[model samples]
Target chain A: MAPALFHLFALLTVASAVGVVATKNAVTAAMSFLLCLVGVAGLFVQLDAYLLAFLLLLVYAGAVVALFLFIIMLLDTQGQKNWGFKKFPIFVSLIALGLLLTGLGTFVTRGQLDAPNPNAAGGVGAALKPYAYQLFTTYLLPVQVMGFLLLIAMLGVIVLSKKIDGVEDVK
Target chain B: MIDFWSNLHPVVQGLIKGLAVIMVIFPLAGACSLAERKVSAWMQGRPGPNRAIVPWIAWIPFVGTFLQRLGVFHLMADGAKFLFKEEPVPGHVNKVYFALAPAIAMMPALTTITVVPFGAYFNAAGDAIPLVLANVDVGLLAVFAVSSLGVYSLILAGWASNSKYPFLGSVRASAQLISYELSMTLSVIPVFLWINAPGAPGTMSLAKVVEFQSLPGFWGGTWFVFLMPLSAFIFLVSLFAETNRQPFDMPESEADLVGGFHTEYGAFKWSLFFVAEYSHMLVGSGVFTLLFFGGWNPLPWISLADLVGWLHHATHAAWTIHPLFVGVLSLGIFLGKVLTLIFIFMWVRWTVPRFRYDQVMKLGWQKLLPLAIANLILYALAIAFIQKSAS
Candidate 1:
């Protein structure tokens, strides 16, 4: 049952990932990306990482994708129906292909994919304790760094977006 | 017997629960709409829908006049009207998304209820059984995650309608829902922090939160509202905004946006949005009750489980009756609390005028956000200090 569900999610992820490039409309492509995210979240759920699944939904599906859709609609960027293969940049495509192949080769040869620890503290209540403790103790420095990174990114966006009273070239 | 019941296929149990929830929520939504109208009318010093009576039904015995006066039959009439009303597909509208929008709106509202613990009951063997559909550990988070997707419905509806008013409404909805959602999520953190067992990972389960509140404390039961009134206030305000009720109904402010996202909708499709709105209100109220109010506990000091045990001993009747009685009582208590909260929502809607869009934005992003963050920090320090002193 579990394996079948995993396969279903995996299939959905692949299909929607394909849909991301296959769709002509920007909004449709964004929606496809959202679906792909949900499929990935489903795979996480199958791996018993429910927290990751919800966070994926909350952040990507709920917030980021919604914002993407909002922007797409706001700009009204429709009618880009040109889907010719000639338009595709060969250089970027080759780099992406090379990276994918390298990742797959590593997985097939040297990757030791760790199965989720079945004996690890089970249930949502038990899982959060170690998750938090580890974050605050083991990964505390990295977490703080990430927090600062996010704050910096936010400040950068605000500075870029917000217009100064005397600034004429902002727009 | 307990094992026998527990061993039933989870799919079957889920199906049963889903069916039961639909049966309850649909009528509850209908009744709430009726209540909203009547309550608003009484507050405005006018009679509400007291005249919408079926001629045949109004000719019956004593019950007929009572039901007619209460305008109970208006619910059926409204349902029928929605069913039979003319539904048009505009030429420029996106057909597929327009059709899908209402279903999308309704789905999250229904799905969120699965994690809500209505009550708890003891079986024939006296083991406590929680009365919830799903008891997932991340229950509260699941509710938020799923319900956040409800924004898609309004956005899609507005875009699909291909109308100016709807597009504006949907845009407002997207911004408003997202903004308030931050404060809503932050506000609930303090409640969970308090309810979480000292060394445990912490629970998001509604039932567990209720159990934490029911434990004997300074007030006989320590409701989170007593400990974290700021969180409760933030949560309540955010709930109103999240559900798009007045004075936060800027998304569909009738004066500005004809009908908001549902500008082009009529009949069944339009009614679906209302049903979704009411269900959101219902679920929000239930969550508020469970988190702050003593869920399923009849009174402040009274624990339903102990009272049931006493009642069983006093009656000296069959064992099954005690649990059955307790289950009913608890369900009633839970529903009663939910109803009162819903009434408060209605009362506030009528009392408060709608906020301008800028005012709404400022309140969500500037006011509530900082308040919630400060509350979280305050509670965290308080908890840390108390724990240190105890150690």
Candidate 2:
């Protein structure tokens, strides 16, 4: 029952993600994105990664979706302007789909779908413990770099959003 | 019997636990409301809610007195009032989302409690019984994740209302929550780092974390509060803003928002919003207790086992009891800490003044964020220095 339910949820989640990318209307796309996020969270729960599931829902669905909604509201774009697909978009999509399928086939053929090693020292919870260890120890440099990146992003956002004085640079 | 129950599917067990939490929280929320009123009344030198009686049961004499004494009547009366009250829908609102918002706000708060460790494990018919809904290893993160979802209720409620006040309130809430969430997450990372610091093969499970802190000796037994006081301070302050409590509750300021996000909602729907708020408060306080305070540690310096040992020695008998009894006692201790924290929340709520919207934003973004970052850096350096000295 759980496995069947999980499969159903995963299908819905993937479908909704595709819908989010394909949708023309920004608000609808945002809503679809939210559904995708929620579905993914459900998948996480099914995998017994309850913390990850909650984090997904909380961070992505809660804060990220809220941000998207705020941007949509602020922009207030209406009347559903027809954003026709670029020429060969279907061709590009098909290529991407083929690549995904090829990857999946390779993994299945390689027999990588076998049950996980039960004797592995850490279960799912233990698997995640290394994230913190890596963050502070081995990957401390990268962690600090990421912090710098976030700071830069923050500054860029403020500058872009703030009103400028009498200077409009034309292309 | 315990073994049979333990064999049930985890999801089913989770659902049962979730239902029990909801049942417990509803009355706790109501009691919180009553407590708030009584506390406020006393502070202002006035009587509060002493006259409201259970009309059906008040005439029964002895039974009525028992009902009144237990505050059972008040609970029923509150429920009745909510049921009978008019659910006013305003002219210019998205009715569906407006209606759904409160439930969205509440569901996550209620669900988050499922992972919270209430007690240590007990031997139940030769099986280990955990005194929590789900004994998932990532319990703390699960709690964090669910608590974070709580902002959506305010955001959706404000947007759905379609009124300028609610819209502003929601906007403020969204921005405030996002800003504070970063700091809150970052601050807690240090604690998680410390918990998993022994380079242990397993993750820092909540149960294990509690056990680690409950070690003998003064320094060993000291709560995270002593080692990481700044983190605890930042987390608590962020928690206040996260839950939209006083000083940070700019979203629901009566003077400005009229009624904030739930301006258009009434009766049961409005009650749901209140339920969500108080439930979040309860869960937030519980998290605070678990993370910073020694969870279920009777005294700051003493362990539960030590206390139980003392009890056994004092009685001068071979003490034997069901594991269920021990689990219940541990749960009681956890609850006692949570209640104390809740009292402090109410006390602070009444004592403090609400910050202006801009001030709230400034505090979160400019003040708390920097402070949290500094604390993290400081902790990292301190840990490094300590390791160096020890080595």
TM-score of chain A of each: 0.81, 0.73
Model 2: per-residue lDDT, tens digit, B261-361? 77778899998889888888888888788788888778777877676667667876544334555567778898899888877887888898888888888
DockQ of each: 0.62, 0.53
* Candidate 2: regions farther than 4 A off: A18-28, A45-55, A78-81, A84-126, A132-151, A162-171, B1-11, B55-72, B121-130, B202-204, B317-322
TM-score of chain B of each: 0.94, 0.91
TM-score of 2: 0.86
Model 2: lDDT of residue A24: 73
lDDT of 2 by residue, A1-171 (tens): 888889889898989999997877675677678878888888877876765677687678878888988877666665657767776997898999999999999998997776877555235432576555556887799999999999999999898877788978534
* Residue A136 C-alpha lDDT in model 1: 92
- The superposed Cα distance between candidate 2 and the true structure at residue B88, in angstroms, equals 2.9
